[model samples]
Target: MKGDLSTLVFTGCETSGCEMSRSRQYDIKRFCFQTWYYDATEGRCSQFWFGGCGGNENKFATQEMCETICVEPPGRGRCYLPRVDGPLRCDQLQPRYYYDYTKKHCVAFWWRGCLGNANNFNSFEECSVFCKDVGPFDEPTTTTVPPPAPQNIQQFAPTPEAQQIDIVSAEQPQQQPQ
Candidate 1:
């Protein structure tokens, strides 16, 4: 663990002038993979990556593959979701590849890209709903994360190579809003 703990920290959401508050464990809001907001900086995606999977093993749910269709294609968002159902959601989202909220994980494939994420959300169901309503993925920031000193897993920052989320930005014929 060599980087700033604040980098991975997430703040709650403020919407419609309503301040939404949640305990560290359960907060209803959205978070981008990058610590700094890119859309705020510019559409330029400056995310750096060594590797990431959003726990989704299926090919169709890949945000990168689906970018061609989704209006706001999910970028590296899947990696953080942790709970998915089917093939990665790609250019043309197949229903079978759709996320199943009840499974607490993806259904047909190694991942569903559906169930709410444990890494980011409160419950498996919450993670699923969040992913289904909002795109589930994140872009890796370029900052280097030195290898863990091996003292504490809780203190360890994920390897920089392990930070990149696999996803794309594009519109598809069948993809729905994230």
Candidate 2:
């Protein structure tokens, strides 16, 4: 793309007088946040790739913000209700896989805390028991074949032909020793 002057944030030549007069000079502050929401349909915290410009009120500035909105409410029913595992960490939970009701398969999600519910499972195998039946997790395999070697191509050459005989001496004169 061609360089656009209108999109330039700083020209490095702005006078102090211009800076003082302008209310907002080169507002190039870019803000990016990982926004998450409790996907009741998926039974996990679904994330969105937000380009921080204009957004809706449901949008949050942090993962905590999303949790406050979607998780804190009583009977929010956003998360999974897995079997009660003792001392489930409500805080400092790690990301793990859970079964998505809508997708009918296992998916990755950041667990917020240890809460006893079938929607929550320690692993995909655990979740699969209560949810839809999914096949065992298998690593993807790849096979590569090397390219063929270059061959020496043979070229054709011209063959020699018979030479023509000169007949001028036979008709003129048989001058032997002049």
lDDT of 1 at 69: 17
lDDT of 1: 0.26
Alpha carbon lDDT of each predicted model: 0.26, 0.37
Best by lDDT: 2
Across residues 35-129, which tens digit of lDDT does each residue of candidate 2 receive? 55434333334466555665434444466544443433222132222222223223333445544434545555545445422345566665555
- Worst ten-residue run, lDDT, model 2? 9-18
Candidate 1: tens digits of C-alpha lDDT, residues 49-121: 2122331111122333222111122332332222222223212221222233333333322222332222233
Instruction: Tell me each candidate's TM-score.
Output: 0.15, 0.25
lDDT score for residue 97 of model 1: 23
Candidate 1, residue 94: Cα displacement in angstroms equals 34
Q: What is the Cα-based TM-score of model 1?
A: 0.15
